[model samples]
Target: MTNALVFLDTETTGLHHDRRPWEIALIRREPNGYTTELRVFVADVDLSSAELMGLNVGHFYDTHPSFRTDSPMRLPAGDEEFQTGPGVWLAVEAKAAVLVERMTRGATIVGNNPTFDVEVLAAMLRRHKLCPAWHYHPIDVVSQALGFLSVLNLRMLGDLLAPELAEDLTPPVKSDKLSKLCGITPPEGDDRHTAIGDARWVQRWYDRLSNPLDGDDETTSVQAQ
Candidate 1:
């Protein structure tokens, strides 16, 4: 078991491994319920892909290009310093240093699709001749949710085979998306595509799974943090 859980998420220039991450967020939660949040915006990088995706997903406002001298897009929440004359621009080495400072050894990384985030960060680290700071295995919420659904389906079958076991089994229901599992209904004004917003959602999903509510009928009022 780990002493702390680091919920992490990233917003990249694109989906490919070669793409760069312009923004990253991490929320470190200790066993005592204390939490610290860090969000970083890399100063220099291509924002074309990130802009397009964010627009398509309705999270990024369709404003002036981020690279423009008079860009209209608002800086990510809590990242005002990056909104200088041209825009935020952190060198690769500086970004790496911040990541190293936050990601200490023995801390379990948690994310929605953790592998992608890990691979992107690893690529960045390698480019700077640095090694990964966290453990190899990350806690992936998507995979965990899939496993839960699989076991739930299995128990349903078992109960059907033996009625006596029905009392201990939850009724079979179609597996749903992570939003449904955590009862998260993204509010109209909520920031969606940002790294910090997504990381918080993943953390809340993990919490819900850790302490499931009574009477499992595939729906609950457990709101995302």
Candidate 2:
């Protein structure tokens, strides 16, 4: 089995509040070193209620794959390119069918905030009458990083590793801070809100958390090998 199942992210039309994900990206790593990836934008979204800030942050107007014909992964002329007519509807349905297979094959969804991502994904899938077959329990990278660093809570080691934790930040540090401690630099600029970039960013954090460490590396490494 693959040690790391999947890394995922989405760009939505609303802010942190209830929103709909219009763009999706994910990466699945296999034991044999092959990686499967997908990046797509769902053209159909009800932006009537989308927040102004949400549209700004996600660059909804600027980088939406529909307008960007230069995208390397852009579907052929008749596919996602068609904005109107029967072609567009067929393409959209075809894309949804592909997602049903690809999204569930990995069987797990992992991300910085997986709950929100999965919720949007489920809604998107259901819109096309498809069901989400991913594992019920999604993995949150922030929680995983917290657990990885929880070793510092040990009285003896707390004093030895990251001595400034007691003085600098308060208990229950935020997700961004925790990621920094794990040597993950937050993505910025275009990478900040783009689906594919953010998904890869999540993968970076997952890689850090999965690093070989004392007492844990032996078991995981053996399984991976």
Candidate 3:
């Protein structure tokens, strides 16, 4: 197990590259044989059915075995919007706290689509005027999958190249998190667009695919402190 790695996932209003997360989830791999799960929500953000439909993101939660619920699960209640930028700042604050609490030097924050994850995270930090205490970057699993396969699409890659892990995941329709790809059935709980919850799933999926113990060279921890 990678003691220093932080598996990260995020849930946002939509797939817009500039969008911000309404919730966050993080799972830290401790030096000891323990993992910590951290979840946070932006209390002020609000989303309507129509706005979410416009993004075509309703199915991301509806189809997932672990996250479907009647009431919005894993999210704070109130009026909030990432487009306002203040909510983005709050998210950065929450993420930084999770990092410090773990006492990690540098984190390898793994995600299914790291480009968007990293960009949103960095933008959130900038909005908050905060910098992560540890060096963190979004690890793009798609690129990693591409390295293992000639063609690339989450569903296609999940079907062909990801057999080793796919058996564990629920096949994704559009923009599902990496957890579904890792065969990790989310616990029976509400997945209210929390970034940290999503991050934990991504981390687990990353470990499943790039576990060092399994003799795969792809597992790379951040620069050890």
Model 2 weakest lDDT span, ten residues long: 216-225
Task: Evaluate all candidate structures by whole-model CA lDDT and list the values in order.
Answer: 0.59, 0.65, 0.48
Alpha-carbon shift of residue 87 in model 3 (angstroms): 20
Model 3 misplaced regions, further than 4 Å: 1-3, 31-33, 46-51, 54-105, 134-137, 149-197, 212-225
* TM-score winner: 2
Q: State the lDDT of candidate 3 residue by residue for 2-61, as single tens digits.
A: 426666666666766557555555656655535555544444333442246522453444
Question: Which 10-residue span in candidate 1 carries the lowest summed lDDT?
Answer: 216-225
Cα RMSD of all models vs. native, in order, equals 8.5, 6.9, 9.6
Q: Identify the runs in model 2 with alpha carbons over 4 angstroms from their true place.
A: 1-4, 15-18, 67-97, 154-172, 212-225
Candidate 1 residues 154-206, lDDT tens each?
Answer: 45555444343333324332223434544544322445677767877777777
TM-scores of all models? 0.65, 0.73, 0.52
**Per-residue lDDT of model 2, residues 1-225, tens digit only:** 545366788778786555776676777665554556666566655676788797787877776655444642345555543333211221353364456346456467789888888887777667677777777888898888777766556444556546654334345667667777767777877777788788878877887787735232221211110
User: Candidate 1: which pairs clash?
Assistant: 43-88, 43-89, 43-90
* lDDT (C-alpha) at residue 59 in model 3: 48
Candidate 1 structure, TM-score to reference: 0.65
Sort by TM-score, top down from the best: 2, 1, 3
